[model samples]
Target chain A: MSETGDGSLSPARPSRGMFGVSGSSDTSGFNGLATPVHADLSTPKPYGSWYDEATDHLAEVFGGFGDAIERIVVDRGELTLHVKREHILELCRTMRDDPSLRFELLSSVSGVDYIDSPRRLHAVYHLTSMTYRRRLRLEVATTVEDPHIPSVVSVYPTADWHEREAWDFFGIVFDGHPALTRIQMPDDWIGHPQRKDYPLGGIDVEYKGAHVPPPDERRSYA
Target chain B: MTTTDTPGTGASPTDPFAPSRDTTEGRIFTLVGGDWDSLTDEAISGTEKMVVNMGPQHPSTHGVLRLVLELEGETVTECRLVIGYLHTGIEKSTEYRNWVQGVTFVTRMDYLAPLYNETAYCLAVEKLLGITDDIPERATVIRVLVMELQRIASHLVWLATGGLELGAMGMMLYGWREREVILEILELITGLRMNHAYVRPGGVIQDLPPGAVDKIREFLVYMPKKIKENEGLLAGNPIWAARNKNVGVIDASGCVALGVTGPLLRAAGLPWDLRKQEPYCGYETYEFDVPTRENGDCWARFEVRVAEMRESLKIIEQCLGKLRPGPVMIGDKKIAWPAQLALGSDGMGNSLDHIRNIMGTSMEALIHHFKLVTEGFRVPAGQVYVPIESPRGEMGYHVVSDGGTRPYRVHVRDPSFVNLQAVPAMTEGSMISDVIAAVASVDPVMGGVDR
Candidate 1:
């Protein structure tokens, strides 16, 4: 938290003095700032809004592999498409190329493990489309035994590090990643830390005459 | 630190570890039984490359970000970024906290812009409970106001640090000066500056405090001039422009492929702002334009951010105008408790004016207070994902409940972590100097990245 000579955080302000608006006073806009806009929550939610239609359209694009699509959940203005592990890359490719539903951007790729689910591992892809200004959530489910799915790196290069992260944390392997090494965790780390079944603590490092139990052995404060 | 200028310092039988022509070119008798003279060409002629370890403690990194750089004559051949040194496993920790208490945790994750984190988490929980409508009008407006203010503060840090990275020390100073105004506003309203848990699940922690309106008014007066002064210093300067312009250019297609968003996506000639495309917190009600540009360079990103700051100011002004006195939190006593007044000279729970009625007459008031605090509200068993236009990009929270007070699982899609994926794509093949410019453009807050 070092300070500059003028007592500002950063020495230069790039956009300064170009705009004619006087920075000295808060008079003009603040005085006439418009009334608060009330949100209309009472309107009946359309049974199949445009978002739902888009999801269905994406599903149709993967016709032969339609069985891979498990469930479509639309909540909080986001669409989540749950798919099987084997068909994730294909689904992502289709979603990206489809003109009607161009989910070109894979905004985020992270892994989650539902301890209770039969297929415990899930690689969640948060996709966005620049053209349509719409978002779609693509999820692929796998088991801890073989957490392999074809990489979407060909479709979206950004998936390289994201896939590496998934591989590192949940042990979900992406097949076609050029260099699918660990991104956050160390290179030779043993266990997938984010998985629900995995313990938080490292090995049995004894501390103060007591052998330290694995993370799961720790008590839950709640 | 003796210089081993002597060509061959008496090599022993165990000195096969010595650098030699055998090691460099493998042209000589590369025998295991070679003497010291056989390795003379190998040791001195071998290219000297320096390796610098930049942190897990470096100040410029913002957090415990460690970089191992292989430098050959000031040119980096390879760079390895190491993180998780700041990892608190907040996502895993989220599973054990209740929906209401979860706001406090998420807010701390993106320490710079805590409001966005709180808003995203609450929106997800509200969606799961199907209580989006239950969020009061005043609450939504207040949420929007605070979030936009947080955006300005967050961007100020980005501008300051980005300038600092490029050796423009003055920019860093002005940036913090402006950010302090936002912090003061936060403290006045929420009782804390950085990690204010004001925006909660059902509503805010409480209503806006006394004199919050005037403080915000004063800040609005002070900020614009400072922003203008900052722009004057760096925006059009020949050196700054040369250093940033076209230094790290990534087009729309490239940006899309890398999953980059926010100013980076917009600078790449895509006008995909979440507030414009998918309006949250009643952003649709405000009249503000999505700032976009054609040049996908460091300079373009900086320009877009400057324009965005103006838009945010417009939105903030609008919120103030509509700041008609009303309840900040929802009226559901089941979720929010009644504001209690202080007692008189004789210490007691109730004020002297209403002491008789609270103790003797109103058992319902006592019961309501007790119920509201002890067993917090319960959210139904379900999952919901909510996205908000954070300063970084589309920040979202995916929360799951299992018919209990605590959430079954809570995961945050922090924009910094997500946006960091595009860094190498933006930096590869470009001059190593452009790496700093490109990274500064993405504006990553590493807490969010590591979390």
Candidate 2:
């Protein structure tokens, strides 16, 4: 554990706000407001109707690799699996191939940059199984310095462009992606635009020669 | 331009062909000459190929979309679509504005189906606020009605544009003519012909204007006859059939693998409509059929879209019948919009009564108005992805709020962006002319694609 410079000991694990910008006071009248950290919660047995059976079947299938899964969260009637970055491809393959867990369609692949966390770049995948009329979300996170995850394009060819987009926006490297060049941005464009620290690049609005500053520099609301 | 003809002139300035070079296989030659068959033969074989760039400005392309094609004579060997020409950073812009104002930004994403974009984003924000179940019943019915009308309008544009691209110029007129009636209705309610930010987080911007239901009833009656007229114009015509049938074919498995949805998926014989699969906005209570076709071709997509308009008509009629007088917005004043936004002679503004009360009645009322308008309401810290069936396909908004007035991050999983990826899979190995049909069938609104 490390000291947070205020005589308070930080959590042993990498908690939220570990990497956020320090010393900047919030101007939204919430100056010392504490955002509740989303701690991993383990659901008790019989975790809803199909959620239990699905987890049990997954446990049976990935018997030895069950440790790679960090947490299983059931929130707002949706199931999400926090998987270790290294085992995402294997889990996706199993999820797609297994008849009982036939998540045949990759609904979307997007990246969320949680700059406050140690593992800042979160790659979110939404999988839909038309046969079973079910959907599941799989999430994997990696640090800014070493953000690499195996590409799932082999299992779902539709992930090819999405991986490129994730790479283009959040700078999360998808290893083994066939030509993972920038998809949305220009090939020569600078820095990943979607990261929290990246500037919004909004130009000042000049209406009738009156100047208005950009959104970030406007009246602070945190 | 001057043309010179000379044979075996290695150094002659008039030579029309580049100097031929010897290879292990044979002589590799660049045909700058006027011979057509030799060039076609060489291109057809593995010896040579041509690369062509289609419009970021082409008329047939729905908007600013560019495609790089590798051509082997007239057959397309490969097709690569380059999007993002119209990227406006709507998702990035939402972080700067409050939750209620986000509707104005997202409504511009899919300009043809602006209501769906607004509805989807509002639903996600509502879900994040944990007020999904608290939306008023009247508001839900209005949402259904407005969404169905937008669907018909969007499908009309597709039909008109698709017909014009396939050389039926008259469809452009008929489709736009029928669509104008719906736009009039939308204008009557939302006060904008396009990009109406009518759908809000708690409810719609306002309740239905007087006689709005009767106008919609008139449109419901008038639209079916026009749809039949459109079918009559193209359904039995051999030229249209030849241009569409069996072209741009992708089976159900291919569509699933490529993550294609909406009519393109339905055309491939999959009845996977989000309205039925995962109902939102009280869609489960509405009676309608998810139209599907056997073949996933340009023709099948056309048929599915047309059939969907009829089904939308059915849903609209049901909505009109179910239109009971009730409040359109939620009762929670803290989260609900403070004023009934109305269009005046100048532009949109707070109604006169609201302005008078806030300014003259009480100081507390004035303070409440200022706080709600400036800082907006704060949402609890959380993340949610709400998916809805839009005109094109499944439109999902992944919104994250860090318990603040402004959103932390908002990512729209726009159907156009995801569905546009299937262009290459649909166009490759088809004729050059078929590319138009294929792209039109997918109906990728570049505004949504690039956003």
Candidate 3:
């Protein structure tokens, strides 16, 4: 920690901003101060509260729990299980069927695009267990080149629309989905609009000889 | 729009058959070559079913929602909900703006329960900032009060529109009439009626206005009588009962499997309200019941919603008695908005006193104010999902911050969007008219559904 002239202590870390952009052309002088990032993602056991107990039960039921799970993160009183992309279907079945860990309801499914990271596209699923009254987040990260994850629609029928939405926004294909059509965007939309690299607006205008490049070819604060 | 940019037989807008969506069994569309007899025979031969397209634009849809129904005579064989007509990309838009500016976008998501959107967003942001407990008691009480008031207003709209669709003309006008009072009270407190972005990250935007507590207290007395009158109007009427009873039924297991929530889930006798179960924003301390019904039908949802409005009035009364005077926003200067607004002689609200003090007395305060306002405070990089019991259901905000002034991503789990999935389960094998009652019971606001 560094003590400022006013005797206030601040952390020492790499800086990137106005809006978390690094080495950008849109330099408005908010790129100097270091901000704290909660990077210690993997929480050590004995994870407190119902989280540890839940994880223990999930491990007991699923034979390949260690292989299926990439990491376990607990932050802000929520449990997030980073699951491998290939095992999502099997893991969801275990979560839903096991008596001790009956996560019957898949509350939501969303996606995130971390542009500079190696495994950039993340498909996130929020599962709710009415039997245990618990919530768990299952995250599956994959690269932009290969953005395929198993669909949980068979286990949780509610995943039908949510999976389609994730595919519509971020282009993370949920393999084995019954009919994975666009849910939120028009079917003719050319590119995923929610990726970090996608322009906020003003990229494509359908006029003759209109030259417009997509996925952030304009001046952007991103 | 590009799908119909040009008109021709090949580019015909009527033949919107996308192969990706054509997974139904034995479904085919053969364009008739002006042969009325053959067309009639083909449609009635059981090899082809009559398909009805109701609304991306009809009155019964409540908003812009389209349903494609394949029918056998009067019974619906298949019901498919085609949404996304009202997608505004609010989730993608929030990634580009600062945290304080996010509330404006989120409140427009579930327009009926706008306060719930604001509160859930603020609570998630607060959780990311690690200042959840630092929120003052007065602010929490005000948030609970305003949200419950929003609940009543939202349910009133539900009743109004649902009644209008089901042939109860008087209930439509009466339900909307009662909602205007709640909107007026909201306008008096938050300076706007519909999309009031009053709840901020650290706390609420400002303290309750003068006589706001008394107005809410007055509403607490007035609303119960209106709720009772509504029940009396619809509860015993034979037409209402026939139109609603046992229509559009989905039991508890089906509700949970489809992720249906709010009054619909409670109407299935689950009583799984997040307010009573998870208890955020001092809701655990409030004395209220989670109303439930035995049958999972349209009429049961109506009964549950009516009882819920009474419970909301009870909570609002408790909030009136629990109101205390304190700073509504947080005390931290770096995090709080650098202004204390007051009405000026020019008939505008501005932080004149704060401006004068910063300009004249403290040069440091001036610098702090400029820095804080222009480049907002940084939040620690993390993701959090905060869920609240909205009038419709479990409205959740899954917010991710990258330690910047702006959010990395903001995903809203609108109950309307999730609950609309249950329409097929409710409407299939039922009469065509029950589709209206089913959609109304689901209450999927297209703004929320397509956001």
Candidate 4:
């Protein structure tokens, strides 16, 4: 363990940086002092099993596979294609319609905000191909400043609610969505609650006005 | 504004029964008084397309689902669903807690199928930790046992609620009775009747207690007869048949397009059961059938669910046969919490003897315990999506970690959330009454939907 900026020891391998509420309130002294922890666990060529074949087919069908896809990660025996935001819809349509990659069912669409990265907002899509009995994930990254990713509701109608949910939680705008309204949160609710910067809206546990502070800010007997 | 056809055209400005002349969307009627005559007159004259709001609170809409229906004389032209009335932000809360604490939060999502939610979330965590292979065989068996039991319970609830909504109240009683049998067995095994956070990241919170296996076996014998009785109460009844058959007709293609799964998709005849197709938790070793039906309607869903309960019984029986005496939690000391726990007169608490031994000799053991409970074991930084076949459908957890004790993000692809999208597709062309049957067939728990 090496000393951090505040003269506190910070462990080097497999960092435990983000401990408390992510912004200035973080007193756990674990906030990332390292350079870029998640640089996309990019797997190399011959990415074992079906991953290599899938990428080959994607490259064959969609021109500029290198340009559209930023990296191909095969971690935990799952394939994640980190694609550019502009090509998300194009990639999804090809994935759905192409004979080689008929990922007909759009299983889920989720979002993650990596606050440290320049392209902080990531829209993650999980697609399943019932025919091939295979699963593939597509991720699209965008800057928080311009968090716009093309909608894939045209190709997979199921993505409509999923996209709206991503918009509701992460504030990632899905361009050309039928009705991009707040889904899980109220329409009048103000900022995205799931982003890294958003304060976890919490209250103290209370009974008859006697309360214990929220867990993170509580005193510890360590 | 469709001002061409306005009932209560010349009423007092302050009249309680006066129908406000609004735009083409539809007019708003301020009927504080019971003006039945005026209401009928207004309904007959005030535009052919009448917009009726069913509920954020209606009984038959299956949990806080609001349907905005555009009806043209009993025929629904358009049906739109308004959900999000039950959002608890469980996903956001998981990011704040340690990895093990996440079970309590996730188990509350799909309340009826709580074990499935926990198993799915835990499986994803295990996969992320790369300890999937290290999990003990007994734990895998118990996980499967509890999950299949939850499947039966959840399907029984669907049967109960679906029957009650369609007017067969007797069937509802029978369905819930059988479900109670399973829930009792579950309460004995896990600690609660519902939302049991029994399944943990490494393994189950505890192993099956004494007589739990016998009780499950007893349920295996009892439920098949109960399912048959339930089928007898509804399958032949003319009103029940008429109310259900061809009511919520969503074809296989429709199911695929709308991302609907579980029994609804199986009833549509694709047989896309994740338990069979994507077998996790050693489900491949267990013998069970994926029941399917061709009608793709409420009756078809009813048939599929009943058949599935019998299959769950089969799997539960297999699980009982497979249970071997061994450790339930993993053996790795650093990963496992409280290394040893004792049951019986001690009332299922951590072993005091083990604690004493560790405290007297090993400072490292105390530190390991302290770090584990306080700040969970660090997972390698990456993301993983693990989907399991929940009673509603494919319930998945998309978990991302920044190599930390707490998860970076945990997003649930709740099947209830996805299948609720098919409400419009099923109910739009059908009559106003059929909307209830359509939604009941979908069987969405709003807790999962709005979570």
Superposed by TM-score, candidate 3 places the C-alpha of residue B99 at a distance from the truth, in angstroms, of 0.5
DockQ for model 4 equals 0.33
Regions of model 1 farther than 4 Å from truth: A1-47, A51-60, A73-78, A186-190, A198-222, B1-52, B70-72, B337-375
On a 0 to 100 scale, what is the lDDT of residue B302 in model 4?
89
Lowest summed lDDT window (length 10), candidate 3 chain B: B18-27
Candidate 1 lDDT over A17-43, as tens digits, reads 211123434222222111111111111
- Ranked by TM-score, the better of candidates 1 and 4 is 4
Best by DockQ: 3
- Deviation (Å) of B17 in candidate 2: 10
Q: List the residue pairs that clash in candidate 4.
A: A17-A30, B55-B66
Worst 10 residues of 1 chain A by lDDT: A1-10
lDDT of 2 by residue, B1-451 (tens): 1223333344344336544555786544565756777877886677887899999999889989899999877889999988878977787878877788889999999999999999999888887677888999899899999999999999999999999999999999999998999999999988899999899999998999988988988888788999999988999899999999999999899988988889999999999899999999988998999999998999999999999999999999999888888888888877888887766888878898888888998786776677677667776555677889998998988887666677778888888888888989888999999999999988889999888
Backbone clashes in each candidate structure, one number apiece?
A: 29, 0, 0, 2
- Ten consecutive residues with minimal summed lDDT in candidate 4 chain A? A1-10
Task: Encode model 2's per-residue lDDT on A45-164: one tens digit a residue.
Answer: 555758889988998897545687887766555677889988889899999999999999998888988777778898999999898988888989999899899999988888988888
The estimated TM-scores of all candidates read 0.79, 0.87, 0.89, 0.88
Candidate 2 regions exceeding 4 Å error are: A1-46, A202-222, B1-46, B342-348, B362-364
* Model 4, residue A159: C-alpha shift (Å): 0.4
